[model samples]
Target: MSNRIYEAYVVHENDQGKYKGNIEKKRVDDLPKHGVLIRVFYSSLNYKDALSATGHKGITNSYPHIPGIDAAGVIEHSDDRRFKEGQNVIVTSFGLGENTPGGYGQYIRVPGDWLVPMPEGLTPFESMVIGTAGFTAALGVYKLRQNDVFPEDGPILVTGATGGVGSLAVAILGRLGYNITAATGKLQKKDYLMMLGARDVIHRDKVKGQSSKPLLQSRWAGVVDTVGGSILDTAIRQTKPNGAVTCCGNILGAELNTNIYPFILRGVSLIGLDSGRCLMPLRKRIWRLLANEWKPTMLEQIAQEVSLSELDGEIKKILRGDQAGRIVVNLNINAQS
Candidate 1:
C-alpha cells in the first residue's frame, strides 16, 4: 500500500498487427506532468473507446495507450489556481483516452482547462454514468433549443435509441415534456426503450422504409440522430418545415447520402454535434443542465457499473453492438468493493 504505483489498462499493438490490453502497474510519476492530477474513481466506456482499443488509427494514432474518454474523481494535485487537492471533478473529451492516456487508469494528469468541477447533486458514480455520452445527449437538445425548437413544436425523433447517447436523449426529452419517438434496429429492445420514457418505440426498418421523395411527411419538430447514413437521411426528409436535426454519430455508416430538398423545400436544419470540442462555456452550461432540469430521470436505470477486471468482456460486448446504455468503470474499488 505504500507503493505509489497505480494500475491501469494500457493498450499495445505489436508490429505484426496484433493488439493487447491489460491492467499494468504505472507509477504516479509516469503520468504526464501538467495542470492537475486526478485520482480517478470512475470512468465510462463509449464507442470511441472500442475503436481505439481495437487499433482504429482514426480514433487513436498511438499504441500502448490507455483508452477511456470520460472520468470522474478528486483532484490529487494542481498547478493551476482554479483547482486544489481533494476537490471532486470530472474530465471528458479534450483528447483524453485518444492520443493522451485516458480514464482507464486510476490516475490522470491533464491540463487545468480539461477539468470540469463536478456538478452539484451528482456523485462520482452518477457523473460517470452521465459522462461524455450524457454530455453529447444534452448537447443535441441544447442545440435544438437554441434554434427555437421546443417540446410544444412537435414530436422529436431519436435514432439509435438503444445506445448510450440515444437512451439518455430519450429520457431527458421525455422529462422535458417532448413527445419522443425512439428508433432502434433491435426489436428485442422495445420495452427497454419504452422504459426510458420514449412515447413510442419503433423499429429502424420502419423509418428506413419511408419514401426518400425529397421531402415526405412533415412528422417531427426536431431530431436527435445517433445512427448516421440512410436513417439520418430519412429523418431529415421526414422532419416538418423549419425543423432541426442533430447528427452526432456514424454508427450505421460515415457516408451521408442525401439531397437538398429537405433543406430547400422544407427549410430544415442539419446541425452537427461535436461533443469533443464544445467550447468550455457551453460545456459547463450543458453539465449544469444535466445536473439539474435536463437530468434524465432514468440515469441510474440506463447505466451499468463494472470494475477494471471485468472490462475486457464488457469491451468486447460493446464492440459487437450488444451493449445497451452506459458502462461506468470503477477504478478505485477494493477486491470486495
Candidate 2:
C-alpha cells in the first residue's frame, strides 16, 4: 500500500442547486471501513450512474458522492476471513456506487457480504465489461425462463434496444435461441440492434398504439422491458397468454397507466426487476452464469472502455440515451496497491 492519495470523480454541489462531478483527491483511509478494501481495476457506467450524477435524490441523497454502480477489482485487505488480500472480486447493485463511495474512484471498501468472488472464467477487466447492465440482462432472462418462456412461444420483445440492458438482453436471449424484436425510437440505430441478434427493430411509435384499449393483438411471447410508462403498458397488453414481462428501469416514466385486462384475461405477468436491493445469494448465482454459460460471445464488443477523466462526458451521454452499450472506467492507473 502507498500513502499517496488517488483521484476520484466525486459529485459536488454549487450554490445554484446544480450538481457537478469532478475529479478529487482522496486517501485510502478516507474510504468507509468494513468488508474488503478493493483496488478497483475497472468500473462501468449505467443509467443509475447518470441519475446520481444529475442529483437525483432518490438514487443518491448526498453530495460529493462517487458514482459507479459496477466494479471489478483485486482485494487489498479483508476484515472477513472468507475473503483475503490479493483475491479478485466483483461488486454491483448493492448500495455500491449509490449511497456508498462507489466504483468511480480508484478504491472502495464495501461489506464482504456485498462482494462476489470474481468467477473463475472471467478476468477482472472482462467481468466489468459485463458489469451491472449485463447482470441485470441475465437476471431478466432468468426471470423469463423461470416463467417458462421459450423461443418457440413467440418473439421476445426487448425495449430500449440500444441501451446497456436492452443490448445485453438481445445478445443473451439470441444466444439462448430466442427470437428477439427490439423496440426503440432511434431508427438510425436499427442496424446496430439487428447485429446484436434482434430479428427486427420496431420504432417506439409502433408500440405506443393509438387506442388505449385494454388489450391488443398478441405479438410477443415474453418481454424484457427496460423502459417503463406506455412502453411497459403496451408490452403487457401485447404479450401472448400466460406470458411474462420483466419490468425494469423507468427511463421513459415510472408510473403505469393501464387496465388489468392483460393480467386477468390473458394471464400476463408483469414482473418487477429491482437490480439494486437484489438478494445476495441470487446475485452471486447470476454473476457465476455471466462468467460462464450465460456469458455473451461478444462481451468485449459491447463495452467502450474509457479513462477516469473521460467519465464526465459519458455521464451526459447516458442521460440522453445516446451512448451505446456499457462504458467501463479504469481507475487504478494512478494508484499503487
Candidate 3:
C-alpha cells in the first residue's frame, strides 16, 4: 500500500444537485479493491465523459466521481495471474467513468478481464488517441465489412464527420481505399475532413432527409453514423441496395423515426455498435486491426494533447459540439517520475 497522494479531476454534487469539477488530491486507497491496479499514463475525453462530468443522471447516477472512459497505462499490482506488475494495458467502457471511478485519476483499479494488453506497434499516447471513440469507429467499420460492403461498391458516408468516431472511421475506411464522403454541421472544418481522407464533404442538412418518404434514392454504399435521430434515419433511407449502416452514438436523439422500406425494400442492414460491452475476442481482433491494416496515417492530426488540469474547457467544447478531434489527457505530464 503506497501512501502517495495523486492529483485527479473530481466532480462533486451539491445538496441542490448542482455539480462542480476541480483538480484535487486523492490517495491510492481511494481506488476500489479490484483485480489490478494501474498507474494510468494517458486518457482521452469522449462525449460520454462530458455527460458524466456534467451530472447527466443517465450516464452517472452518482457524483463525486472521476470521468474518463479511456485509459492506457502500466500495471502496478495484480491479483490475477494473467496480468503482472509493469505490464502495459488499456481499459475502456465496461462501466468506466460512469458508476466506477475512471481514468481522470492517475490510478485506477479494475478487474483483470476489463484490461487489454497494449498491442505491439502502438504507444500509450496512440492508444488513448484511439480510445473509445476510435474503438467504436472500428466496430462500425467491422460491421460494414461483415455485411460484405467493400470499397468498390460505392462511396462510404460518415455522419458527425468532425467528431472523434466519425473522423477515425473516415480515416480507416480511406486507408482501405474506399471512396469516403463526410457529413458535418461544421462546414469550416472542410479541410480537416478532407485531410482525414474524405473525398468529399456534404452539409449535414443534405443528409437529413427532407421528405416524409420511408426510403430515398440510394446514395451510399456503407454508412458510419455517430449521430442518431435524423442523420441515422437519413443514412438508412439513402443507403444503396444491400448496403450496411452502423449506428453507434445518439448525440442527436435516440428515436429512430424511419419506416421499414429501407430495410425490407433495399435490403439495407442497420448494425449497432457497442464498444462498451463488446466481447473480448472481438475487441482483441479490432485492436489488432487498428494497430495494423486500419491504422490511420494522420493519427497525430486527429489528436490534441492536454494536461489533466486543462480538461474543463475541452469538456465544454465537446458538449457544445465545437471540438473537432480527440483530446488526450496526459496524466504523467506533471507527475513525479
Candidate 4:
C-alpha cells in the first residue's frame, strides 16, 4: 500500500485490566487482509468510538485496537476492480471500527463493499464532519421522509438535540423547512440548537413522560430519537396518528418500558436505524442525501476539528455526555501543531 507508514491511537489492556490509549506508529500491512487500502484524510468521533477506545467489551473484544467509525480519504491500493488507486471514498460502520482496524489510524484497509465513493458536494474533511453521526442522523430524517412525514404535517421532535446525531438531524430537518422542537439535556446550548434550525428548544426532561398513561397529548408529526429508553418511549406515545419515529441510539438506556398502544392505536411507526448494517444501496443513498439537498445548512456549526493527539480528552468528554457536536480528526495535521 502507498499510504504505508502512519500512526494510530492504540488502546492497550493494562496488567491491571485498565485501558489506556496512546499514539503509536503503525504499518499498512498490520491491517487485516482486505480489498482496499485507504489513506484517511479525516475521521470523526462518535459515541461508539468512545466506547471502543475505553475498551468496552460489548463494542470491542480485543486489545491493541484503533477505534473510529467514520473515515474519508483516497484509495492507496485496491485488490478489487471496482475501486482504483487514488479514488476518493468514504467508509463508516460495517465493522470498520469494531472488529476491524479502523479510521483512527491514518490508513485503513477495508472490504470493497464497505465503501461509498465520496459524494459530489463534499470534500474529505467535510464528509468526515458529517461522519457516522451525521449519516445516521440523515438516515433517520430519510425514514421520516420515506414515511410521508412532511414539514407542513407538524413539528418534528429531536431528542438529545445537542448531540452529534440529534444536532445534525435538527439541521437537516431545518434545511428541509421542517419546524423542529429540539429536546436537549444541556439547555444552556439552546441558542446553539436554535442556530442549527430548531424553531423550539426544550429540555430533555420534557420528553420523559410523567404518567403511566398509554398516550399523552398528540404532538410531533415525526421524531428523530437519538437516545433510547424513556425518551423514546415517551416520544412514541406522544406521536400523532400515522407518525413515524426513527431510533438510532441507546446511550440513555436500551430497555424500553413501552407497550403497543402507540403502534396499534396511533399507527406510529418505529423505524430502527442501524447505519452499520444498512444495505449498500440505501447507505449510498443516505450519503448522497447528506451531500445534496438534505445537507445541513450550518455544517460548520455542527462540527469542530481536532488532531489525533487531542482525541483522548474528547473521548472522555463524550463518555461524560459533555460533547455538544461532532468532533472531526484531521489526519493530515500533526500533534505538535
Candidate 5:
C-alpha cells in the first residue's frame, strides 16, 4: 500500500447555509472501505454532478463530498477475485457520486459489484467520453430498437440535441443509419447538430406543445427525448402508429400534462429510462455494444476534456444550458495514486 495524497473537488456547506465547491487535498485513507480501490484516470461531468456540486439535496444529502457519477480508471488494489490490480474499470450511478465518495477524487474505493471491466475497443478517456450520459443514451436507443423502431421507420426526433445525452444519442443513432431530426433551443448549434449526423434541425420551440390536445400529427417514427414537460408530450403526440419514444431526462420540467390519446390512438409506446439502476446484465450488454457496434465515429467532436480545476465553470455552463456536447474531467493530470 502507498501513502498518497491526492487532489479532489469537494463541496461544502457554509455557515450561511450556502454551498461552494473547491479543490482540496485528500488522503487515500479517507476513502470508503470497499473491495476495490481504483485510481481514477478520467471522470465525466453530468447534470447530476452539477446538482450535487451545488448542494441539491435530491442529488446529494451530505457535504464535503466528491461528485462524479461516471469514472474510468485502473484498479490499484482489490479484495475480490473478480478484479485484479492494473485492470481497467468503469463505474457509473448505482449510488456512486451521491451517497458515496465518488470519482471526483483521484482514488476511490467502491464495492466490486459496481465495477465493469472497461470494454474492448475503448480507452479510459474514450470510456469517460461515453460516460453516464452516453450510457443513458445507449439505454434509450436500446429500448427503442427493442420495440422494433428502425431507421426504415421514418425520421427519429431527438430533443435537447446539443446536450450530453441527446448529442450522444444522435451520434449513435446516426451511426446505426437512422434518419435523425434534432431539436435544440440553441439555434446557433444547428451546424453542430448536423455534424452529429442529424438530417434535419428544428427549434425546440417548434416542438413545445402549447395546446391541451392529446394527439398531434404523427410525424416521427421514433423519438429520443432528453427534455421532459412539453417537448416530451409533443414527441409522444407526434409519434407514428406503433412508434416508440424513450424519455431519460427532465431538464425542462417533471410533470406530464398530456392525455392518453397518443397511446390509445396511435399505439405509441412511451419508455422511461432509469440508467442509474439499470440491471447489471443489461448494463454490461449496452457497454459492450457501445464499445463495438454502436460506437460513434465522432467521439472527439462530441466531448470536451477539462481538468479538475476547470470543472466549476463547466458546471455553471451546464446549469445555464450553455454547454454543448459532453465535458470529460481528466483526474490524472498531475495526480498520484
Candidate 6:
C-alpha cells in the first residue's frame, strides 16, 4: 500500500497554451493526501471532464490533471473506519477532475464522505454506466416528481436527448410511464431515442430560439433541460401553468435571457441541479433511486466503453456536442479488477 505504480490519463499544458492528455505512468505517492484510496475499475465521461481535459480555466485552472468526474471501484486503503479495504464504493464530482486529481486514473484518493457505498443491486461497471450524468438525470427527475410533476400532467420535454443526461432522463421517465418528447440537434439518432422509450423525437431547431412575447403556446407540462441558454428560455415560456423545469447543463450557453412571465404569471418553477456538490444525503437518495425503481431499463444501452488511451478523440467528440450516450472508462482493461 505504501509503494505502487499505476497508469493514468494526464492532461498537460504546453508553453504554447495548448492542452494535451495522454496515458502515462504515475505513482501512488503522487496522489493527494486523503483518507480513502480507491482502486478504480470504471469511470465515465461528461462535458465538464472534456472541458477540464482541454484546459478550460473555469472547470480546471490547474494543469496536469486527470479528468474524470465519476468513479466506481474497490477501496485499496482507508484511514477512515467507515470504509475498509476491498469494499466497493462510488465517488462523483466534489471537485474531482477539477482542482483535485480525478478518476481517470487506476486509483484515486478522496475524503471518505465523498463516497457512497455501492448499492446492493449495482456493480461497479453498472454504477459507472450511470455515472454523474445518469445521477444528475435521476436527480432532476426526482426533483420534478417532488414538485408534483407526474406522468399524467402532460408530455415532458427533454432537451439534448442524445447526450448522457438527456438519454438517461428519457429512459427513466419512460419507465415511469411519462410521455417524453426528446429534442436533439442530431436528428439521425431518432431511432436511438425512440428505443430509449421516447414517445416523440423532435429536431433541436423546434426547441431553440426566443420569442418577443412573454409567453408562447404552452406545449410541455414539464421539462428536463440538459443544454441551457435560449432553449431553456424557450421551454420556460412554453411550459404549462404550474409546470416545472430542471436545468443541469449549459452546453448551449450559460446566459439565460428571459422574462418573469414564466415564473410569475405561468407559475413555472425553474430548479437548478448541481450534482457535483449536492449534499451527501441527497446523493445517497439519488443513487438509491438510480439502483432501484428509477433505474433505466435501457441502462446498458446508454454506455460504451473506452480505455484511457482512447479518450482523446472521445473528448473532442463530446466537446463538439457529438456524443449520444455515456462513455465508460475501463481503467485496467488488460488487468483483472
**Per-candidate clash tally:** 0, 0, 0, 0, 0, 0
Candidate 4 at 27: error in angstroms? 1.6
Cα lDDT tens digits, model 3, 24-64, are 88988888866799999999999999999999999998879
The local lDDT score (0 to 100) that residue 334 gets in candidate 5 is 58
State in Å the error of residue 134, model 4: 0.9
Cα distance off (Å), candidate 2, residue 268 = 1.0
Name model 1 segments beyond 4 Å from true. Answer: 1-3, 334-337
Q: After superposition, how far is residue 257 of candidate 3 from its true place, in Å?
A: 0.9
The models' CA-based lDDT, in order, is 0.89, 0.87, 0.92, 0.89, 0.91, 0.90
- Give the Å shift of residue 36 in candidate 2: 1.0
Q: What overall lDDT, based on C-alpha atoms, would model 4 receive against the true structure?
A: 0.89
Over 209-255, each residue of candidate 5 has an lDDT whose tens digit, in order, gives 65667778889999999999989998898899999999988888999
lDDT of 1 by residue, 1-337 (tens): 2246888988899999978898888887778866798888999999899889889999999788899999899998889999999999989999999998899998889999998898897889988888999899999999999888998899999999999899889988988999999998787998888888888888988777477587778889999999898899999999999999999998788998899999988889999999999999999988988889988878788888888888888889988989999999999764321
Candidate 3 Cα misplacement greater than 4 A, ranges:
none
**TM-score of candidate 4 relative to the true fold:** 0.97
Clashing pairs in 3: none
List per-candidate RMSD values in Å. Answer: 1.8, 1.6, 1.1, 1.6, 1.1, 1.4
Cα lDDT over the full model 1 = 0.89
Model 6, position 156: C-alpha lDDT score: 99
Highest lDDT model number: 3
Taking the tens digit of each residue's C-alpha lDDT, what string does model 2 give over 1-337? Answer: 4464777889997889899888888888788856688988999998888899889998899888998988889888899899999999998877898899999988888988888899989998888888888888898999999999988888999998889999899989988889999998887988778878889999988887546888999999999999898888988989999999998888779899989999999999889888777798899898888878887877778888898778889988888778887788888655433
Using Cα atoms with residue i matched to residue i, what is each candidate's TM-score against the true structure?
Answer: 0.97, 0.96, 0.98, 0.97, 0.98, 0.97
Q: For residues 25-99, could you state the per-residue lDDT of candidate 6 as single tens digits?
A: 888889987679999999999888998998899999888888898899999899899999999999997887788
**Which parts of model 5 are misplaced by more than 4 Å?**
none
**Which of candidates 4 and 5 reaches a greater lDDT?**
5
List ranges where model 6 is wrong by over 4 Å: 334-337
- For candidate 5, give the lDDT: 0.91
